[model samples]
Target: MSLRRLLRTDAAALIAAHRASVALHRSWVTPCLDQAGFEAWFSRTLAEDYLSLIALERGSGAVVGVFNASQISRGNFLSAYLGYYACVPYAGRGLMREALPQAIAYLFGEIGLHRIEANIQPGNAASIALARGAGFRLEGFSPRYLRIDGVWQDHERWALLADEAGF
Candidate 1:
């Protein structure tokens, strides 16, 4: 699979992929984020210059996953937060193992970001594993860090620094 920047033309495919991903993680993801919300969110990200990417099957052009990184500034820190999901069909295929490093490299090298973080639901083993595989170190846990599936959930924070990773 290859990763590419999300395009306006990819809206329909992204919606379909989003729905499939939601279904797969319905117990964790809020169902209220419907198609309209997805479109609007994507638009807002585009306007904010966030890097949103889609993983595509190289041969068939099928969208297999979506990933996003948004630059954030707080006090003296300038960093980015990472979010991603792989469609069920693409899970366990090592696609993220390939995509994430590229994304991180781009964030640090091209975007000039110093750090990237992943806030993963505590019980989401797949995501935690993915973050570790991508060389992010688990920092600590946050209680009631986010609302998932309409309920407050705890999250494990993980981070990677560009200098540390030598990227």
Candidate 2:
């Protein structure tokens, strides 16, 4: 798999992927499934504080998943929050497991971030395991942390620092 920054031209494929993965992503994420929504969401990724990337199959060029590093802070706190989801045809194929370390390296080395955090719903074992496998440690928990699918959900905070990443 290969990782690259998200492109505006990816709208059709991304929307199709998200639409197809609706069941797999139910209650986990709500990606834009149309052109207008994609336009609005994609606009934010153009900002300096957000680094949005897409994982692709090296040969077929199919989208495997998307990894976003948002709300990046500089100066004393060079950190960001992570948000991601695997697309249907590619979910559970160990593609993300292979791409995550590359994403971490991009965040720590290319983006020059000191820390990256991924907050996961307690029941989302898959997400939690992904973070853990990528060297993130359980930091703590937050009640009603983020509002998803119109409901506030609890989350476990997992984080990895640049030093811990050996960068």
Per-prediction TM-score, please? 0.88, 0.98
Highest-scoring model, lDDT? 2
Which digits, one per residue and each the tens of the lDDT, describe model 1 over residues 24-78? 7675554224567666766756655477878788888887777788665434575
- Candidate achieving the largest TM-score: 2
Candidates' C-alpha lDDT: 0.77, 0.93
The per-residue C-alpha lDDT of model 2 at residue 124 equals: 93
